[model samples]
Target: MATLLHIDSSVFPAAGSASRAVAETFRKAWEEQHPEGTVIYRDLATDPVPHLTADAHTAGFADPSAHTPEQAAVFAERLKLIEELEAADAVLIGAPMYNFTIPSTLKAWLDNVILVGRTAGDSPSVKGTPVTVVASRGGSYAPGTPREGYEYVQNYLSAVLGDMLGLEADFIVPELTMAPQVPAMAELVPLFESSRERAHQDATVKAKTLAERLAA
Candidate 1:
């Protein structure tokens, strides 16, 4: 059976988090289609991965035989994370834009998973994996928006997960998420709601399609 790696990195609670909700829409459909398959769930909000440090960076590049005890520990953790990604037939990541970028927790996970000469670099280990990203932004960042160039989450993910890791990624973005909550964006409430509904629908369709494709 196929395995799916599901990662959630919303600091907000699942109940109100747009990214989490959209990812769940995909996950629910995926589970329905693959009842017997496995799901590896990582809730980064509650179990946050450590941000990349000098030690972690050294551990990733060090030879296993030469790693010190502390470096070995860091290496082992990164190995586990990479192995999970390697083993998965598909991946789902909930990436909520925080401060115009991705959550620190999600960035941490990316740091751990990206291993030079392994997942990336010349001799990349993993490739052709399908990844579905639920990217929820608090404000509008479309091409015509003033903050168009300010959005970094999706572009960063595409570069790392898609170009570097060789994963085929599809993004489901729900923009203007703060419209209802922020008084300054009150006029965009209707647009926000419409975008959210479209995101959920797209998630459902993509999930089912991916499940079927994996099954085939």
Candidate 2:
């Protein structure tokens, strides 16, 4: 059976988080299409991945057999995270914008998965892995918007996961997620609702289509 790696990094609970909601919609569609498929769910907010550090970095580059006790320990964690990615047929990530970028936990996960000689480098290991990102932004950042170029979540992920690691990534972005809650964004409430609804609709379509494609 196929396996899907579902990752959620929203600090807010599922009910209040737009990214997580979008991801849930996709999950439902995915489950409907693949009843027997396996899902590996990771909620980074409650169980955050440790941020990369000097030791982790050192261990990632060093030969596994030559690693010191501490380095070996760190490398073991990296191996577990990479194994999850390598084993999955598809990936879905809930990435809400936090201060114009992705959550630290998600970034930490990325750091661990970008295995130098294995997943990266000249003759990379993993390639064409399909990834869907539920990107929820608090404010608008589409083309022509004042903050048009300020969005980094999609760009960063695409660069690292797609361009660098050769993963095939697509996104369903829900903009102005803070419109209903933030007083200053009250004027954009309608836009927020529309964007959110559109995201869910798109998620359904994408999820079903992806399932068909993967099954074939």
Per-candidate local distance difference test: 0.92, 0.91
Error at 101, model 1, angstroms: 0.4
Cα deviation of 176, candidate 2, in Å: 0.7
Clash number for each model: 0, 0
Residue ranges of candidate 2 with Cα displaced over 4 Å: none
lDDT over C-alpha atoms for residue 215 of model 2: 93
TM-scores of the models, in the order given: 0.97, 0.97
Clashing pairs in 1: none
**Compared with the true structure, what per-residue lDDT tens digits does model 1 show for residues 1-216?**
989999999988878899999999899999999999999999999998777778779987778899898888878888899999999999999999999899888989999999989999876677889999999999988888899999898899999998899899999999999998999999999999999999999999999999999888
